[model samples]
Target: MTPRTTKPQMSVKDFEELARRAPEFVRLEFINGKVQVKPVPDGNHGEIVMWLIRRCMQQRPELSLYPEQGLKVEAYRKGRARPDGCLAPEENFVGQGEWAEPGGVLMTVEVTSRDADTDQRDRVEKPDGYAASGIPVYLLIDRDACSVTVHAEPEGGSYRSITTRPFGAVVELPDPVGITLETQKLKDYAD
Candidate 1:
């Protein structure tokens, strides 16, 4: 008879504990009871993230932007996500723990990396997760496709509206964050 073996599923608590103990260079996330790991982003990714942060700060001084902040996307699910950029009211994180519950988060941004699975997660699974968590916006920068996508209007565990634009175009963010983002400066990973 063949030996029976099964991979152990990690709970949200377990994931959080493991992530806390992980090295600073490692990025860890729990998605649908599965642990996902990735190395720290490259220079191009950091540049784009900083660019977006600067732009958002210039436009909305009252809001707070954090990079790679862990977020609780669902209470019932054993998963925690660390978005590339997270926008929220400054007060939301006051006296909070390491992971912020997705209550006052206005938007989350993801800049795709070289991995196809990473791109797919940003394009598909993440939107659903963010929406279900009541986040208002999910921005995806697709390096592979040279496009940016904004998803909003969360309902039924998904965003009801989506808009996509090429790298050179100006994408208008929705109200409450009424600002236009210039994507022309966003160079592809190959650059």
Candidate 2:
């Protein structure tokens, strides 16, 4: 018979400690006690993220847009995620710790990367994690699939609604943003 083995799940404190020890140049996420390290984004990824930042800023000058901000999702499991872009009022993060809890976050955007694990997190785990944490909106731009998915109305550990649009189509964001994002210029890395 084969021996059974199990990986020890990290406590929230342990995850926080790990993040604190990690180098500033790297991006890290704690999902269900497992740590995921992401590489620095490529030019295409940065371009898309910057475009979103500009558009969001234009729409709501009062709110602040932060790139690659670590977010704490969920109280029990405590999933820690860093989105490509985070939109929130400045007050929410003024005196907070390095990681901000999801309560004050208005929206989070994730652009798919070359890594399969990173893509999976953006497509699958992050939406559920953010929703479970009560974050209002989770936006995923999947380069592999050439689509943008908006997940909102979090409830019961999942998003109650999801909307998807192709690369060239405009995606209409909900309240707090209420802006139609132009995706025509967002090119896939393979392009």
Best by lDDT: 1
Candidate 1 lDDT tens digits, 47-106: 888988999999998887889888887434445889999998777777767787787889
Residue pairs in steric clash, candidate 2? none
lDDT of each: 0.80, 0.78
* Clashes in predicted model 1: 0
Model 2, 13-66: lDDT tens per residue?
887888788888877788756778877888888888888888988988888778
lDDT of 2 at 191: 44
Which 10 consecutive residues of model 1 have the lowest summed lDDT? 1-10
